[model samples]
Target: MKKILNPCFLAGIIAVFSLTACRDDKMEETTPDQVQTANAKPEQPNPSEKSCSYVDSNWSWSAVLINTLPTTTDTNFMNSQMVNIAKMWGKSTPTLLFVNDPVSPGSTYNAASYKTGYRIYYGYAIYNDAKAKGGDIVNAMILAHEYGHQLQYAYNLPTVKENTGRSIDLEADGFAGYYLRRPNGYNKTDFSQIAAAYEFAQSIGDYQTTNPGHHGTPAQRRSAVRLGFLIGQYDVTAKDFDTTFFAYYNGVLDGSLKMVDNTIRPEIKAYLDQYVDELKKIQSGEISAEEFKNLK
Candidate 1:
């Protein structure tokens, strides 16, 4: 049976998920002077260019090439996705980069967003892994999540009130979820696909409570994505979605709201309930990195 979430309970879930944030060590903060001083010359991609090319020099956003992918096909796919995302915000396309490795080894399992461009370091490796595990939809989710970061950068959102980066991370996750459910976005009408992609998000959750870069516990991350997916059910623009999400996110963070239990879809509720205790422990700093790593 379909479950209905109580408004207050839903608010609390969003609150917990939104409270955490992450720091992208790889993302360089561009200064006002840098943005202002950027060259005005338009550097368009050559029609024959197969690899990365310039999108906008004013923002210093450019597409870059990496040696890991079979062809420009993957990169092209990402560019198209970015274009779709950009259109939602009424912004120009950001640059794309396909890189072989991240500065931090083994981190290629993830993607990072930069003011200059979005980097899919280890693109082929991550794509192949996600494809094997959950099909191409997983790949779409990853791109959507990273693009969520770009949205944050574009909107200067979250209006943070805490010392951590969790708010930004959660909001980005929410944005990705929102996009995936949109008709013009991933058009993933099946909730099962979202559930499958969410596993990837859960896998990346960390137990670094004191770390300013902490993304959130597995449960919190899972809930955040789910909340975003639910919010997308409504007809709203990207800006309106952001505004509504933050209102709920901040309401919970400030204690102006409380959690209440309501029926949840059996499949999703069962999946999330399994990690409730673990998430509680994570938020309380009772879970260690070893334990977090071993969580299934």
Candidate 2:
């Protein structure tokens, strides 16, 4: 299980802003040593013995994931989330890769591969700060989200528009949302904390939705995550996922999406109906400032 640690805490926190600028697409070529080490996927540790190990060094950035969260009991919650998602798709674990990219440290997530398996480099700085802030839900969500990209790499799921980058990212967000709400996740925790973490993560959504690599507009991302959670709440399966994902996610982006009211799938919509009102409240800003502050 992942362990929790004290992060590089910062004070006077403001609402987290999503970094939205699009940079040049040029990628640095991977070195031979990196190619060899990053290509190897470690054996999946027994869940009971999984824990986070911190390796401190001089660098511009880093991603430090703890085994446990102070606010929840989901041990190694990050690893567990990715493993569960892989099982759902009938795939093996991808190597968890870390690197320092001066080009776009703000743009931390990317999936790479080798002959054996895949690897993921999480932006160290952003991830570290998030972890310090008790962003366990967000941390697990980010891991699963990146793994969703690994899924795209494996299955070559049709992208929204290949060069535009919207379809791939939106789908990945959908994938992350898909697992976050599952019973297998940060289990035995309160929904309020989940919501808090979800919001914390959302605060990082980029404002420039038009950028080719822009993940999604903030609102679109929020909807994507909510959609993912809704699926898990209703026990939706992967085999029948695409049809449902496209219809629901499109409505969300176009501003035509309403909680459970406009959902086209009867059975799944029925399962999510209870949260419709609460969701609408969040979307509409009905919750008071004091109320939101009490969440953690």
Candidate 3:
């Protein structure tokens, strides 16, 4: 059955997750020579020792995945992207820990294990499904989406006030969309590939009404992705990106009062022009409410 999440509870859930499970204050960078055991939960590193993982491999995101995507080629691209994105928020070398559970209990698509940098399980099984349905381009979208969360950590973006189901989840989805449209990494100028990934990710947000902590409903999730995509059509620094992101996001969660039509940021405005019509169509319900479901 479809689930509808109250915005407030979703905000609380974010806080609760932070307070109970997340260890943001404790995360430290890994050093080059330090070969810590994969599962060994180490204390947060000191200032000089912070290191980002630079895995090298044929494995798509094995560089970021703790043990699952192990490969020989250094995956500095992930580290580079994280570093570049984090710099905007004044963070350096945030630890990227990996959890090995095939089916991580709490949330899927990986989340920060508290303030300890970023935790990405990248479960092969999960990626397999995403690949089968969405393809590699779509998978790239997913990776970028998860990295967006890392940006949130480095910058200390305001946690949602209410832990309801919709706001936080949608915001993250929006963030993912925002990055996909950027030129640096994926360089996806068009929305088609990103949209498919967005839809694929949202479909897994299936839960009954009783699952209070479930992600947003399918419609809300789609809106979030569309919003992100709309924002992506323009170029902005990480600083500008976060500021605009939170402003628009808070506006979306609070009410319709946060509408923005200004193209004053000439560059952003120019980029957004490409997506204006598509955004309007989405806002107008041009897209069907299709969802992807996890096979039993």
Candidate 4:
């Protein structure tokens, strides 16, 4: 484990498999329904819950699943990402849980963050699926997004409240976007790479907007992340991120955010003015994915 100064925040990523503080079985029981914020929430461990086993498979996601502890390189890579993201949001690293049961896979297709456990869970299956769908950076995006929920739980955020599933999930999506570009995070200086990583966000999108767990449509998610990436250009605190994101959430979704007037800091507005129309196109699907990726 990479040493951290904060005892309260010294979440042992090794705990999921080897430690005893957090219970992997119980966490899986709390898995958030299709709706709800925080990547994937967990449940109390119920022994009666269904379970399965894993081995080499013809299936795609299992292709990468050796279902063993990650190698030193893999652990270091995740530690760095967690450190960067924690630094970016001004929070401590939460415990990291690897939710793969080499014996019996309890939760294989989800990821989540929990106020209860003070950590994030990344299922091996979902990680591989993300790689198969959108490459490794997408997992970075996922990790960042889950940590974003940690921010919310810590901050009581998103000043704009819709009281719906989308509000929470979409804002987390925005946070992921911000992390992807921040110097301390992924440092994605190129818009093309950032834009191309949209597949994972879009892939998780659902049509059940009224569902308590509806995250957001694919188009809305794409636009939310795009707006967050644009906001990453500024050096802002966690509170500042929430303010700006909520301030423009509507405009980003409908493409109505304009630079014509006051309220927004002039420098930030100037930076974002160029993307207003394109934001509209993305959210509305007026622009194809190819076109979005081609953006400079």
Candidate 5:
């Protein structure tokens, strides 16, 4: 499991503008019927049906089993959603497991993808927490992000110049954004709800730019997803989407592609203005390290 935090809270004037931008997009307003149909709750899976069984003990990737199990309803729902996303990539569905324990201490969320046959292990705490925040769409987004890693495994994508994992992580964020905005996936036409759910993505942003495993900062992460969402405006296959995302993403990393001007998206700028200074402090090691870990 990876230890990650949630997006910073948008407050006061910034919160109003940020929330409104997310809520007021014209695209979201045009598809109320489809949104209702796509997001309708599914019948809970029966617990007696046995949702998951152990596949192998010596698999390339494995973890200690948590004592708790997800309810049949949750397991079935997650599996169904995984199937939907896999179809988007024209690949067979990957195995999904719901774990009870955290991957480590002081972490309420932990999820990992084993490249061997594209397996995913999600902690129950994270699953329940995502559902609580924004219904199943949030849960779907989390699963989609993990599946993004599987796509990397399948395609061997994102040839990175930097040794850090930020490139891979940000690409996965883009993949999730692409799927979330698609009609057959989450069918979330409104960019605002997608932006709101991105709070989860923002929270997981890390300030450890020098760390080999560092993911991008909150602002960078948000920008990546937004780029993906914009690209998703067109109908593109998964491979094509990767090509497009990498073209822009590589530019951002190599200092060739200019970063999107946040002034145009006032709401995003509002949130970033509030957090960027603190993030800089964390990155420079000027503040106590715990502050970065404890970001909420």
Candidate 6:
């Protein structure tokens, strides 16, 4: 919910972009402290007090979510996988609200988390779009991502610094990657599914790097998820996880660390090195969604 400077002025330019209030900045995404107080709209009444509601009356926005997750035999993951996501992080389940705004179903094309309100909301339209793309895996990734913000609020986790929300969003994407691969989590041993989840992450990415709510470019988001899956190979305390994440992530973004750096441990660099080439391919846009799914 970071402030959109001029809705009327940018309305035309925003057709291809989302800007979901909290996550992407349209009707969702900002942390509580970052809510748009000036542009705030009164909460809209809905069928159930607990169901997700779209209240941004004055702002009409939308984004197409193109999911590239590999197919799964269990296509009903969206119905049962959310609770397991919370379990993976050892956090209490938050209230789950499905937003099927009768008045404007298309307007509910966003997903978000309320840290203080202790809930997560998924827009039914967005969920349906995801379901159509790759069944429930896409939606499961979304739920895991919103849950990542919950972990952030609970532990007051440190995030990579950026002027926009990209850092937190990318970190959330990373956490989703970890969940996708964890044996006790999604239990996906195959990198194809791990890659599948990242493709889902890519759908939410935007090119608005300077926008206050920019998540990340598609490639960067995929890289973040890939890094998280790599980390999932071992179990580490949250603090160590944070430490380890930044150690490599900073290098991934800025290329500050070299192959022979002392900061990265031998075992880690060795393990991570195996994927460096593919990661570079992603960042350079050499890989496509179809390619991502079929990769060995």
lDDT of 3 at 260: 65
Q: Of the pair 3 and 5, which is ahead by TM-score? A: 5
Q: Per-residue CA lDDT of candidate 2, range 159-264, in tens? A: 2454545565667666776776666654523345456555644554555556554555555566566666666655554534544566555554653443433434
| Rank list by TM-score | 4, 6, 5, 1, 2, 3
Instruction: For residue 50, give model 2's deviation from the true position in Å.
Output: 32
Clashing pairs in 5: 5-203, 5-204, 6-203, 7-202, 7-203, 22-192, 28-190
Which model scores highest in lDDT?
A: 4
RMSD of each: 14.6, 12.0, 11.8, 9.0, 15.7, 8.9
Candidate 4 residue spans exceeding 4 A from truth: 1-69, 102-106, 258-263
State the lDDT of candidate 3 residue by residue for 20-75, as single tens digits. Answer: 12222323331011111122233333333223322211111112235223222223
Best by TM-score: 4
- Root-mean-square deviation of candidate 1: 14.6
Better of 2 and 6 by TM-score: 6
lDDT of each: 0.51, 0.47, 0.44, 0.63, 0.55, 0.59
Task: Quote model 6's TM-score.
Answer: 0.71
Can you write out model 4's per-residue Cα lDDT over 46-140, one digit (the tens) per residue?
33322221211111111112223355665566667878889877777787755554322323455667766577766665655556677768878
lDDT of 1 by residue, 1-296 (tens): 00011211110001122111212222244211110111323244354422332222222222332432444676566668778876765667665544322221121233556655443232334555566677766667777777776666666666554566677777777777777887878877655557667766666666665666666556556556655776666656555556555544532232232223243334434544444454456444465644543444
Please estimate how well model 1 matches the true structure, expressed as its whole-model Cα lDDT.
Answer: 0.51
TM-score of 4: 0.77
Task: For residue 109, give model 4's deviation from the true position in Å.
Answer: 1.2
CA error at residue 183 for candidate 3, angstroms: 1.0
TM-score of 5: 0.63
